[model samples]
Target: MINKKNQETLSHHLQKLEDISPKQLNKDQKDLIKKMLELLFNDPNTTTLEFENAYRVLIQRVKVGFTFDAAPSEAKNTISLLVKDEEKSFVNDPLKPHNQLIIGENYDALKNLLVIEGERESKVLTLFTM
Candidate 1:
């Protein structure tokens, strides 16, 4: 829970935050402002550590954009392995890596590719969308 002195400080900052247009502030700043207001009005008993954790989570969500159910990190970690069809071949060239055709949800495919890329020592990614 916040002490009287800290509450005063938060109130002062919140006042200053309200004066600025939200567009002028970055995402982190905006999330901070939202959390600050919530803390001041809704959950006064929330501890500083808890407030900080919630603030960090808000910032993370902003960074990851839209997601459903689990957080992005958790979603990424749980990505299933890409299924390879050795029988299907575009070219018989044994010297070159074969192009893959992935069939799945767009976000899931992209996240799975990212996880695969991260495991390698060198990564080069190129995307073409139509």
Candidate 2:
């Protein structure tokens, strides 16, 4: 069981983490700090030494995760358009919009589909063949 003082310290650190501006830290940094705070908050066995180490890592901006060339780049929110290829299309209807095949990461595609299809009056049928 966590002592009352430790609980208060955890609460104070969590509040401090939350108070940090989004612009000041990249998404990965924010995620790392948030996860660390969550672990500290949820774990009853968390020690003062662990908390000190975590804070030291955060304050010093020590490299934690795998570094890549794209790590520094911000993720872009983009809407992907599904356009039908006439040459490869087996069937075509003049009255209806052409059926499209979207090839890319599913998460971003789902987000785009949700945004675009949500605007339509009719329900959209989504199929994931893969």
Candidate 3:
């Protein structure tokens, strides 16, 4: 059985997280982003590193507001955003391969992505299926 001290610590952390009531991102995205932050954040080893609100990515996506371009010159890469939370998150694991599907064949795959991406608190989603 878990010890009482550990339990209390866990409880307190849960309460703090609940009180904060942060929004959710897709689990995969959230995990990926946190790992990126853990490594690339100003300092990797320090716990509780300060950061700006919501995770951000440096790469630019090719979107004409609603639709993305037919091909990025770099082509066939996935962009993921990760966030942090207490529950079983994806931090510390190697990132799963993003589907680098080509540009024109993205619609059906986009729909499928939503099926897998549906579980988390992700209010936003993007699909770059080939």
Candidate 4:
């Protein structure tokens, strides 16, 4: 959650970030940029201390969630993938240990993967298509 004041500050910070080149940022600024990104992406595990530290130079206010109109739902064909209790490897290459094939509900899998990536601070480029 982000208070209105902090949200405005974050908007300003985003504009500032856009105005400056990545190379121009100092170490502290670079770290702040990362923290801002984490917050914007809704990193679920972000601690209160981390949030406070990130916004310390900005405004202090009780955080609140924003409200918006719900998006319209679409009707589409659905498919299911079956998985066994035991893990099975579809591909096994010692040279490509990081390569994996995830078979599950796409949305849930994507969310879980994003959480893992956030925790590890990993740079993972994912491409998805229907």
Candidate 5:
């Protein structure tokens, strides 16, 4: 089961990982990650990432699950985003502005989905920084 603290850590990792370009993942690390993703995809009953070790696994799973937008015709013209910060105090926080990082493990599952959209730059990633 995914505990609370562990969940937060995962979010942090995902945020950090986003900054690192795919080219940086050396041959070995990339290969291992690829294998891990394959294993996870082959088995849907795999355990979801709830911590550091699981971070790599979770990324792999998300990437495989979503078909990133590479090239498109005139029809598919939508941009997507990967990471997002859904500030709970959207209408609240009268003192502070609306921009805030919603980095917490509890948001891992949702963030993963967003990242895929980001790769494609789909309409979903077009978040307004209010």
Candidate 6:
């Protein structure tokens, strides 16, 4: 079973992997791979073979029976501010605010936002997250 920390780590790795392209080398992907290697072997000076082996091991580990059980929900056309479990005491724009506070797992919230936004006729100009 995947713990919360492992789930968060895997989500981070998945995000990094999704940003990589086949046509060019990505610095983020390289850094992520190096970090993975460092975590696995406590050594960043990994050879190509070692990197490949580590990648294979990661693939095998990821092939488990894990699934995204969160269902997408509808949202209004407003600026979304995603936050974790912690409650924020202050608001920058309390008056004339068009912000929607989404509190939960960021990955799932993003997915749900995408789903909601996809159904709208108007296109979203920008998505800012912290």
- Model 2 residue 128 lDDT? 32
RMSD of each: 15.9, 12.6, 25.1, 21.8, 23.2, 19.3
Per-model TM-score, in order, reads 0.27, 0.38, 0.19, 0.24, 0.23, 0.24
For residues 1-130, write the lDDT of model 5, one tens digit per residue. Answer: 4455544554555455555556555455545654554454345465544233565554564455544556644324443444446863235567887656666654545555666746567553555332
Predicted candidate 4 versus true structure: per-residue lDDT over 1-130, tens digit per residue: 5557655655665665556544455456656665665564366565555655665433221123233466766434533333434556355677887856777758755655566667455443332221
> Residue-pair clashes per candidate, as listed?
0, 0, 6, 0, 13, 0
Specify the highest-lDDT model's number: 2
For candidate 3, write residues 61-113 as lDDT tens digits: 11112343456453245543444456865444457665544678676556545
TM-score of candidate 1 to 2 decimals: 0.27
Rank ordering of all candidates by lDDT, starting from the highest: 2, 1, 6, 4, 5, 3
Write down the worst ten-residue block by lDDT for model 3. 56-65
Q: Report the lDDT tens digits of candidate 2 across residue range 1-130.
A: 6678777887777676667655555667767887877687567676777876777677455334433453554357645687657887665678887876767757665776677678552443333322
Worst 10 residues of 1 by lDDT: 121-130
Winner on lDDT (1 vs 3): 1
lDDT of each: 0.60, 0.66, 0.41, 0.53, 0.52, 0.55
lDDT of 2 at 103: 79
Give the per-residue lDDT of model 1 (tens digit) for 1-130.
Answer: 4578666756665565556554455657776666765754457676666655655554454456643464445553355978767787356588866776667668766877777778652433323221
Model 2, which residues run further than 4 Å from truth? Answer: 26-28, 62-130
Model 3 TM-score, 2 decimals: 0.19
Compute the lDDT of residue 24 as modeled in candidate 6: 38
Residue 30, candidate 2: Cα error in Å is 2.5
**Which pairs clash in model 2?**
none
Q: Find the candidate with the highest TM-score and give its number.
A: 2
What value does the lDDT take at residue 74 in candidate 5? Answer: 38
Report residue 51 deviation for candidate 6 (angstroms).
1.4
Candidate 2 global lDDT: 0.66
